[model samples]
Target: MALDPQAKALLDMVYRVGAPRFHELDVAQARHSFEKLQFALRPEMPAVASVTDVPIPQARAADGVIMARLYRPLSAGPDEILPLTFYFHGGGWCIGNITSHDVLCRELANHSKAAVLSVDYRLAPEHPFPAAVDDALRAVQWSLANAGMLGIDPTRFALAGDSAGGTLSAVTALAQRNAQGPRAALQLLIYPSTDILSQRPSRREFANGYMLDTGSLTWFFEKYLPEEDDWQDWRASPIRAARFDGLPPALIITAGCDPLSDDCKAYGEVLREAGVPVEMLEFEGMVHGFITLGKFFSQANEAVLQAGEALGRAFAAGGAS
Candidate 1:
């Protein structure tokens, strides 16, 4: 199948400008470029009832605090304790932050009718390896413990993210699957990198012209996990986890043209085999990050609607429990 016309046009324009690929720049420059591109490509921001910034303090002052931006849906009642999605934005664990993903978070909140808390976890190269993982786990824990303060329904909490952030969301579900730990109602993964080291067919099939090139993937991995051994760590690659038996149900979304398409499919299948209910959707003709480019892609809204409906179902089930 051919690439979506909009996707192809965006790629053509990007190449025509000769914009430096992410792999061509140093970490700082790459981060700046990524944010600029995000701002330029994303649609006009949707309205949410309210958005507030809150910081989750770390035990060590040196580690710094993680910031989260909260989005309350326009339709949510003032006194209602809404279901919540604790989201992490994707930038290969190196770039992206609350500001870079602001619009997407608003859309998710609006469509899901759930409060969204987008975590600004520490990036790599500076934080590296377990730092992002640690911060992500901490954010989920903090959200669970402080649900009342945040005016969210603890019982209907879920984890959701894209790309590296999606990886983090999956890893968090595995990390907190204890009897005493907070149980996530759902795990919504968007084109997640499950097996960081696995060279699935899609990695090569769509490696070059797709929005997320192999070179950029390599660059991100090199910056975030300099040690080759880090790729095998289950924390870094959730697919390597000892078990997925008790993890929450999942809705894994992939783009057929994404380098991670097969990886996501594999993850979902393994989870299903382990008796965890899983639903995987591959949007043929779409590219990685299609869900964020609503201005150019109608499929973006379709994906969001699907995700929102899934989230709603999970929340309702959680409430029933």
Candidate 2:
């Protein structure tokens, strides 16, 4: 498919601006740049019933705590026990945070009619490989244990995120599936980097001109996984996992122009082949990271609504064990 007009315009504007790309910046600069784009282009925040910041105690004593933001939809009653989605923000596991994804979370909560918890996991470069994975696992574990106190339904809980955040969601869901006790009912992966070792056609096709360029991806990987061997770990690359059986049902979203598009599709195929229910949605002509730029792309809003509806259906179906 040809590039969507809106996406092309966005790309043109980005190139016209002559700003340094992520690969050219330091970690702090990259983060600031990412935040600026999100702030400038994200849709207006949708109203929610309540928003709360909750601290998740770390499993390791030296790791301190993970912070998360909870959003309850306006449709939800104050005392209602709504299903919850644990969201991890995408920034190649290094840049994005809860604040950057606040509006997206609000939109999801309002549309899905489910509470959304946006986890602020540890970033990379400072805390490299496995640290983000550890925080993701710990946050979900803590939330499950305290679901009652948080006024969420443990039985209907799911996991969700975009890009690197999506990778974490998949990894976390996989980890939870094998462990005794509660497992996620659904896994919503949006243009996730499922395979760090992927050499897919999309990666080559969209390598340079797409919003998420090859250089930036390399920069992210270098920061997140200084040790190249860690890239093979299933926690780092869920597509590298030995099996996809027993994982929760999945809703995989992909942007046709994204380098990770093939990764998302391949992961969905793997899940389906393993007998896991899989629903795949591809927004043809869209670029990577377009879902968060609703102000500029109409498809972003449509995609969010679709995602929310999918979550609502899963929740109503009582979710998988």
Per-candidate TM-scores read 0.96, 0.98
On residues 195-304, what C-alpha lDDT tens digit does candidate 1 reach at each position?
88888898889989887898999999988998888889998889999888878899999997898998999999899999999988888889988888777888988898
Off by over 4 Å in 2: none
Quote the positional error of residue 72 for candidate 1 in Å.
0.8
Per-residue lDDT tens digits of candidate 2, residues 170-250? Answer: 999888876755768889999999999899899999999888999999999999999988988999999988888889899
* lDDT leader: 2
What's the distance in Å from true for residue 165, model 1?
0.5
lDDT of model 2 at residue 221? 94
Q: Give each model's whole-structure lDDT.
A: 0.88, 0.92
Give the distance in Å from residue 311's predicted Cα in candidate 1 to where it truly belongs.
Answer: 1.1
185 in model 1: Cα distance from truth in Å?
Answer: 1.1
